[model samples]
Target: MPAWRRIRSLRVRWLVATLAAMAVALVLAGLFLHSLFQDQVMRQHESALTLQLDQLTARLEFDASGQASIDPATLSDPRWGKPYSGLYWQLDEVGAAPESQGAQRSRSLWDDRLHPEPDSPADGQIHVHQGTGPRGVPLLLVERTVFSAETPARHWRLVVAGDLTEVGDASARFARVLTLSLLALGVLLALAALAQVAVGLAPLRALQRALTDLREGRSQRLQGAFPAEVQPLIDDFNGVLDRNAEVVERARTQAGNLAHALKTPLAVLDQAAAPSVTADPAALAALVHEQVTLARRHIDWHLKRARVAAAQRLPGHRTPLAPVVDGLLRVLARVHDARHLDLGADDMPADWAFAGEEQDLQEMLGNLMDNACLWARTRVHVAAQREGDRLVITVEDDGPGIAPEQRQAVLARGVRLDEATPGSGLGLAIVADLAALYEGSLSLDDAPSGGLRARISLPATR
Candidate 1:
């Protein structure tokens, strides 16, 4: 499918939009939380360094010569005496003192010193910064300038630094855990969104199934409870169906009434024109008879067309194939008892129904059976079965069969293969017309009994 079409679907669009929103929310939240945690960790680490700087300043001692010294045993943390232990302090003399004048360090400094910016600080002022410790390790450095309590003229720069690698590791660990936690949350929320979409659209699916049933003549209208959002549409659709059925019924009534109105006058005219009683000119009598016959044929054709137009599209009309065929066979057997033809129908399942009017089904089956009885020398066989959504019916006779080339011509109005056969030649044509009206088909083929076979395919119930 095209990307646009996929997005056009309501379910897909809902899922994509919701998940996109969720993903963006999770990403932003993760970033904000990571930054917050990192800042808090850094502040706590810097606080510890400041406390250490205070301790270093408190232990500082200076002589009148501006020299400073510190005893290793005075420090409380053992790392103060351990060389390159990542926690260290240093003291340097300021103002007129030689660069190497009063350089004293904690034992942890070993042979290296912390290199901070060369900026002087006011007396009793404290500064914090990032600097490099011994061996190029990253450090958080806190420095203060203080005059010795014993000698007011002696000033010393006191500095303390702590390793920053632990803070970095903690921040990195927090980021990884936060990303995983947020991703898991996204997955769970995505599933919830999908389930919500399915539940929300369930009514539309039910409506679709109901429409299918209505179209296939399975049920008359939409049924079952629906959400308020969709209930109005269902009610409106059912109203349209009702109006459609009403219109079709009205048309059928008009067509039947018109048929009766026209047929009565035509019948009277046909009887009046008959030559059984009065002997008018023979030529005039024959002319009147021919015209009356033509008029009658025209009337029948038009009336049948009108009836078919009205009947074919009416939904929710089903007639069982078995009962219709059985009833026809019973009537045909009695009607053709003199011929002593072996006429019977193969059993059809009760569920096989014609998705059309019962009268139409009777007309179709009655015509086909009557034609078969006329042709069959001994037996006529009728059978019906379902093929997919179609009902397939076959009527065969064990008599002289129609040639393949002539079969198509025989279905035309007023066409007959044998003129001697007493029929209006419109039976097959009417059957064909009604079948076409119902969107069905009829074909003639050779029967297995070496006779004619008539097969019809029509819509069937589910």
Candidate 2:
């Protein structure tokens, strides 16, 4: 894949997105902080100049002629006495002729006069401006108009000009420091984002490793502790693995059972066909027919098991208990009409449905109800109800019941309790195996009517 397409990894995507957002935030924050710092620095500088203007105004002495003069020595700052020392003060008469000089200036101005931008200020109010100072140095000027009663017809403008080189240097240094600080912060935040993405996705990494182990046959199922957010997915995958393993085991067992079951019938057929075992033709034919029937029964039993096993995992399968039970009861009532057995189903909710193939449910219930009808004297009752996510079905008969110890044996293949009981002894076994394939169970218990009770639990669906 191309490099851009390769960016589909979640870790890379999260890191890139987080770092980009942090970068933008840090850049904006840096700009805002720098602007605040510059404003504060300029305000402090202007305040200092305003204080100088106030002191210069305070020292002004006007003769009775309204000529403004100031003694430079009275100023506390020594820079006022040095020429071009980056700090200076001057006085100008308001509305004076452009060529006339009626004011005294600080010696720091030397032979150059402070020609600030023309602006009018109210008396005692300071107005700041930017202008060129001695030697063309950039300057911040704080100017204020003063009115003295000693010269009622005239107002004096006192100005303090300071060089901006120092402020410029300070601002530049601040910008450099702020840039470095934000860059460092961005780097640190990026690292933290990377770490967070790694920590958050660690469970997925562990899951990948577990899948690798399972694929390589190192483990039977996905096995590990994960975060709560990911544990459900892990559990579901493990469940799938468990079910697959069970299917494989069931297939192997069915093959073995089928082979073992057909062995006796096939051996008998082979003996009847042997040359030294010649017998009457009719007897031999009957023997072959019986053996073939037994073999076919075993085959059919294994085929049914395989079919149920395959359909057990299918989704969205629903068979209502009411209809299947009612249908089976009606069919059995006629099949056992000679005995006049009362075959009937109890009233069950129509919504009580099995979570499996309808045919499999029919097969299981058919075997159970038929076996009940065979043992029933006059009454066989089928009952079904929902218990949580399971459907419980019971088949009861009012006849001679087997001892508790023998009930289990009756559910084993070909383990007939009585040879006189006309059956292949596979009915109860098939029902038990079918129930097991659907992750259900079958048990033989005592009925309320003093007969056998066969109860089966199957998965239910709403």
Clashes of each: 0, 0
TM-score of 1: 0.54
- Deviation from native of the Cα of residue 337 in model 2, angstroms: 5.1
Model 1 over residues 380-446: C-alpha lDDT tens digits?
9998877899999999999999999999999997798889999988899888988887889999999
Q: How far is candidate 2 from the true structure (C-alpha RMSD, Å)?
A: 3.8
Model 1 alpha-carbon drift over 4 Å, by segment:
1-7, 65-69, 94-102, 120-125, 148-155, 264-462
Q: For each candidate, what is the lDDT?
A: 0.85, 0.87
